[model samples]
Target: MKQTQLCTLVKKSEPIKGVFDFTVEAPAIAAEAEAGQFLHILCGRGVFLRRPISICDVQDKLVRFVFEVKGEGTRELSEFSVGDKIDIIGPLGHGFYVDNEKYKHPAVIGGGIGIFPLLKLSQKLYEPLVVLGFRSADRVMMEEEFRAVSAKTLVATDDGSYGYDGYAIELLGKELMESECDVIYCCGPTPLLKAVQSLAAEKNIDCQLSLEQRMGCGIGACLVCTCKTTHEGMDENMRVCKNGPVFDAREVIL
Candidate 1:
């Protein structure tokens, strides 16, 4: 566990009202943290527990986290200013693994806040196709970033206020069947995950998924983020904060 200062803040979106991007100075964690690892951050003084957020990006001396201020803790985080010091412990959970050869032409599917984590993965994909979903045009984000990294980028809005007029999976599903993509990765709502799982099954395609769960310990110790999987066996409870925030698509029940 390590404690650090909230070095800076970058406001990346006006789309989702309370979302903000935080850039913290955590050289040690950044040195060891991989693309899919997450951080457990405490945004305020005397907060009982920290919030587990995915590590958005990691570089030489900094780690980034893109978060939505959905509740009290995050709301508190939103108020923090530059040079404010906060308690943080992490590079906590497991992350998505990239197999450039096997995933030559890969596709990333993200929904709402879920899109945040996928951005890091895009940096590693050789030629990626990113499909992001939002409720409306006002909610859409990261289009330019995806355009910058991915070979092809598509955006979909539930209400047709942005890119395509449909759900992300619907658009991605159609595109997956028609494209020469070798693998798929996704992070989204439960229903969307189910749909992606079903489609991947039908195609016998390899897919990886990142899960979001309420957590206590951002490490494996508390087992707070336990999830079912069929990977190594039929009855196994995997810890999301440890074993993965990322998993093989077919292995996860959802």
Candidate 2:
């Protein structure tokens, strides 16, 4: 199910420079939202296309999302006040696997803003080992939130300004050397995902990846957000907005 609604902005904050975190009073969207899904937000400043923002978490009748002001659409979105009604369509796209019974231990890894969607996933996993990466310590956001849900939370910074002086996947690799992770869920830049995919393949671990793509429509109607995918040895392209933002690492051609 999907919907286009005027969601009220109930909460707003700037976690870091150029990044906005908001929770909207969208009962309809919140009721059905799942981890890894996204919202297509209508930015009103002459921006014709809707912007896709990842779902951070859903609490009761509110749905939370975090987005960086990379361009005009996002910049306008950031300027919205607490009482404004924003047009949005969501609880959209396929989300990560939520069944945790079969797996004893699972790991969730993300870098920079990609870490947003993995929050709900970590909460759902009960006690996933979470590794998140950022450019520097000052740029890091929501460490305490992840810490509250995850059994152990590790932070990595590129310039050695934080916990570990390397990429997040590297920290995940170190953890895997000791811990028994039955499955892994990751989202980030292309390079990070590729590395994680390789690491998972080498260790023979099951893994899922959330891909990022430029989207025109939040639904399957537009073909702008397609990504290379393979299934049963057959190669094809799948829409990131509909078919998946989440896919098995082995099935994704990336």
Candidate 3:
């Protein structure tokens, strides 16, 4: 629970009009942060609860996060300048559990804001075939970053202004059909997750999911971000902040 400075706020795209990319400063957190871990953030002083954001890209001495300015807290976060600092507590929650040998030629699927966490994961997991879905061409983010790490990348837009003129799932199916991947991992809206889950189950491919749940405490103490899952033999409710923001696709009911 360390307080840090808001170092850089750069707009990545005019995508979705007001969304911005904030490359923040938190060396201590960055040093220890993992691929699927997230940072708990508080934009203004009076906001009692902090917002949980997935870690984006972390370089030496700095950790970055890309967020859409959906509300006042994020809007306020967008207003910070290079040197301005904010109170940030992270890297919270359990990260993605990726198999080193089994995940060779893994395919990653991300839609809209869900792409945030995968960006960091891609940096570590080299050359994954990535599929990103956006509302339009302008709303798209982080194409270049994917190119740096991914062996193959595909983009889909609702209005057909991008790489593929359809949903991300379309591209995902295509990627799966065209290539033989060892495993699959995905993050996005509930519908997209459901679709991916179904696909993974049908295909008999190992899959992992990162869940986005509302939180009171970024850690497990408050039981706010609970999800249903079957661990060993019984069904149980687990807190996302502590037990996992990441889980095996088969373990979760979804």
Candidate 4:
């Protein structure tokens, strides 16, 4: 069920320079929330459009979300204090499908801020192997949290400042070749997603990607968040906020 409520901010943290992690007291939203769905948050009185942030996790009666300050809206959002009442409309959009029986061996990958949405997904999967990518060591976040849920956690950085001195997707490729991963769930920037898409295609593996698209109305009333896709030989524009933020790698035309 969709909710438009004045949720109270229960917790807040700054993991990096501009990145903010916030948890709100919204039991209704949390109860129905799933991995990959986003919250449409009205930053303040001056901000016209709501900022769509991915659902990072959901506890008993709290919903967690993380967002980097990219613009004025997000900057305002970051200024919110604990106990502040926030106007939010969410558990919006489609989320990743969790089917452990059909997918015996699963691997999950994420890069940059895209890593946030995969946390809850990792909790749902059956011992999913988690691989996270970053620009360098300082960019890495939430290693302990992922390790708590996943069978094993791997890290990679573009510079040799982290675990594996290469793209995390490359490490995933190596792991796939050496071990067995029947299904892959990935979320990242376009370049990273493209690489994972190609790698999954080459290995003939089933892959689902969570997209980061610019959205206007998080509920799909407008065309602001549409992405190119092909299904059954038919090319179409699909609303990321409605049809997906998650899709099969083969179907979404990256």
Q: Could you give candidate 2's per-residue lDDT for residues 1-254 as a string of tens digits?
A: 56689999999999789999999999989888899998999988689899999999999999999999998899899999999999999988999997679877999999998999999999999589999999999989889999999999999999999899988988999999999998899999998899999999999999999999999877988799999988778999899999889999999988
TM-score, one value per model: 0.93, 0.98, 0.92, 0.98
For model 4, what is the C-alpha lDDT against the true structure?
A: 0.92
Q: Please write out the lDDT profile of model 1 over residues 1-254, one tens digit for every residue.
A: 44554444433333457778778787777787777677888867646778888888877788888888888888887777767665778777778889897678888999988888888899998989999999999888779988998999999999998889989999998897689877888898888888888888888888888999999877778888899999776868899988899999888986
Off by over 4 Å in 2: none
Candidate structures ordered by TM-score, highest first: 2, 4, 1, 3
Candidate 3, number of clashes: 4
Query: Across residues 165-230, which tens digit of lDDT does each residue of candidate 4 receive?
Result: 999988998898788888999999999999999999999999999998988988888899999999
Clashing pairs in 4: none
**Compared to the true structure, candidate 1 yields what TM-score?**
0.93
- For 112-183, candidate 3 gives per-residue lDDT tens digits of 899989988887774688888888988888888887889988899988998899889888987788798777
lDDT pick, better of 3 and 4: 4
The candidates, ranked best first by lDDT, are: 4, 2, 1, 3
* CA shift of 21, model 4, Å: 1.1
lDDT of each: 0.82, 0.92, 0.81, 0.92
